[model samples]
Target: MDGFSFFIYAFLSIFVIVSPLSGVVTFISLTSNMTLHEKNEIAKKAVILACIIAVFFAVLGNKLLGVFGINVDSLRIAGGILLFTIAFDMMHAKISAESITEEEINRSQEREDIWIFPIALPLLTGPGTISAVIVLMGTAPGFQEKIMILAAIVLTFAISLLMFLFSRRIHRFIGYNGMLVFTRLMGLFLAALAVDLVATGIKNIFPMLGKLV
Candidate 1:
């Protein structure tokens, strides 16, 4: 693909997988007792932390994969399956257990470090996001393409930050059902992306399969 097209793909893939809207409900619930200022502070910290985590993995994930002797293609398939499961849960309008559990959410409400734990680590920059970053980096043919992927990551989290900052207002406007509709639509897109990843991984791993097609 050309550079612009690739960048768009990277941005959309990262954005859909991150699914900021899906987390708005959780964010609102967690910060229900806080003032608007406190909520905005948490949102800033969470998105900044999440963005750092994603960039860190995007830059070094492949080396870590090498340390474990794991192939990029293998991770592609694994990550694709993992993302698909999350997407499936999302399509049902359920909070993805892969990211966080009901118990965790309930427990997080009392924790002061909720921004770092559930919000940053798992919710925003979870395993699937990390895997996708690494895979995108691995698949990039050049440094420029890799940079584009990194830009996409930053843009995705920037949008997430805005979403979190206005999460309460957004929830008030969209309502729970409207949020569900958006989540399901994102889920559909993520499912398609996951299938593409799996197919690409298979094709790369077994070039003979490509010839057969």
Candidate 2:
């Protein structure tokens, strides 16, 4: 691809991963009772964790799949399913945290630090994001392209971290109702992206269909 295409890809990658709207909801849920200082600290930690996780996947996601006897298509299908479920919940504005098993929530509550758990893991870089990155990596034109993708990931996460840190102000400005609407919108986008993933995976698996239909 050319510079323009690369720029667009990088921007989209950042937007998807950073997910400002989702961050708003997550921030409110996680830090509703905390002080500004506490929220800032958590945001810092979460961003660091998110960056580390994304970089790890970008570099070794393929090798990790090999160790488990999995391929990109399997990842795409499984990730698409998971993303679809989340997207449906998003469309409904459901409290995703509430859907977690009671035992898991209890365990998480007992823990002192949650910076790397649900907030940074499934909430940000879940199976869907992982699969998306891996597939994109494969499509990358070369090392330079991969480097730009990484930069986009870092830049986007940085912006997201800042947003979380100021969640209180944003929530006040947008209000609770506005946030809910934004969340659902993001969910709709995610659902559409998930459909694309499934379609791409199916096409890759059934090459003959390309000519038949």
Candidate 3:
């Protein structure tokens, strides 16, 4: 794609792939015991951390992948599995063991911040989103397109931050049952996305499979 097409595609792709709605559910769940102030702080920290990671990966993704002999397809499958694991827990109304530990949940009640783990690393800037950013940025045809990729990352994070700001009002509107319902719905989407990721990665690995019945 040309620069503008790349930019538009990258922008929307980042937004949809990030799935900020799921982040809302996760943020609320993880910070359930925190006050509004704590939740707000966590949101800020998480978004900031996410921005850093996105930009860093966009700039250095190819080098990092080459250094590790890693490829995008592998990342897709790994990310898909991670997202699937998280989706399964969300579907069951529980925290994903891969994302959070029982000990962490117990300690969360007393701790000041838990933004770095589930919030920043895997939750916000997880594999799927990171892989998208890296591939999009790495494939950009020119400097302008690379900048556009960064802009897409910025835009996606801004959208996520907005959702987080209204999280309390959303929680009140949704209530406990509503949150569970929403989480389950989003979980289904994530699960489907995960399966697609795995399938796509496998197809790329073995292109003939795409033609098979």
Give all TM-scores, in the order shown.
Answer: 0.98, 0.86, 0.75
Model 1 over residues 1-213: C-alpha lDDT tens digits? 999999999999999999999999999888999999999999999999999999999999999999999999999999999999999999999999888999999999999999999999899999999999999999899999999999999999999999999898899999999999999999999999999999999999999998997
Question: Per model, how many backbone clashes are there?
Answer: 0, 0, 0
Best by lDDT: 1
| Model 3: residue 20 alpha-carbon error in angstroms | 3.8
lDDT of each: 0.94, 0.71, 0.77
Q: In terms of TM-score, which candidate is stronger, 2 or 3?
A: 2
Best by TM-score: 1
Candidate 3 clash pair list: none
**Could you tell me how far off, in angstroms, the CA of residue 209 lies in candidate 3 after the best superposition?**
2.2
Candidate 1, 128: how far from true, in Å? 0.6
The ten-residue window of minimal lDDT in model 1 covers 93-102
Candidates, ranked, TM-score: 1, 2, 3
**Candidate 1, residue 79: how far the Cα is off, in Å:** 0.4
Residue lDDT tens for model 2, 168-187? 88888998889878878877
Two-way lDDT contest, 1 vs 2, winner: 1
Candidate 3 off by > 4 Å = 1-19, 23-38, 135-149
